[model samples]
Target: MEAHSVQVREACDRRAWVRDSDRSSCKECTKGFSLTRRRHHCRVCGDIVCHSCSATVYLRNTTSNVGRACQSCARPSPDQSTPPPAVYCVICLDPFAAQSDALVVTLPCQHAFHRHCADPWLATHDECPLCRHQLSQDRTAFLEFISF
Candidate 1:
């Protein structure tokens, strides 16, 4: 089960979030929300779910997790190596779909994000989020790379 969980975490793009107001009940159990029975979003499919219908998944193999996933997405897919439309802009928690017109950039740390999202972030942070490696201070190289 641990190995399956690892695969599920890797194969699933668990960042796409659903707007809270979009759902009125759990997609799995069809349980309506109340003050006590709150709705939870499945990190994988972005489906609104109940606590019993969702299971906590650790994407980073850490003690803490980003959120829980519904039972459907928690199961490892048969062909788990190939994930679909999974590239996402961590800044906005939005997926970078293949057909999208958004410009994407990959930092030295290998983390990829939309160019628009990353440019502003790089200007302020001057470092990669996944890796603490500071980007080169040379503006000429950076400018040439982005202009491409």
Candidate 2:
């Protein structure tokens, strides 16, 4: 008899896809959006897509995790291990140096910000206020890496 191994799904939170406001139409089809038709996000490219244009796939992680992926994400790509560059907060322009007690948060793009300042801004926009870099999916992991 041959032994079989069952792959377990890794615990994860969904990646924050790009905001719908960034695009007026589906990225894949380039079809214009309307009130009735809603916008969806591709977990891979973080682009706004339509229901017909998106498909769910298990992306590479510790174990394959299900996520809404675009056609591009479904394709394989070279693995990236190098960490992103570290960046200072653009909102305060001080890189959390203004206050010793300030809570700093680092986004996926490697930009850092005061948690208090970033909280309100993040509510309205997903990108960094200064560099306009998109937020990463593994926000918690990034936060853990930078927390001091």
Best by lDDT: 1
What does the lDDT come to for candidate 1?
0.60
Off by over 4 Å in 1: 1-7, 10-15, 60-66, 80-148
| Worst 10 contiguous positions by lDDT, candidate 2 | 1-10
* Tens-digit lDDT string for candidate 2 (34-104): 97767876656667788778655434452223355555554434463434433455676654454446666
TM, every model: 0.42, 0.37
lDDT of 2: 0.54
Encode model 1's per-residue lDDT on 32-125: one tens digit a residue.
8889889887766777889888765534332232346788876657775543333577777787766546666665444666777767766656
- The residue pairs found clashing in candidate 2 are none
Q: Residue 85's C-alpha lDDT in candidate 1? A: 33
Error of 1 at 136 (Å): 28
Residue 40's lDDT in candidate 1: 80
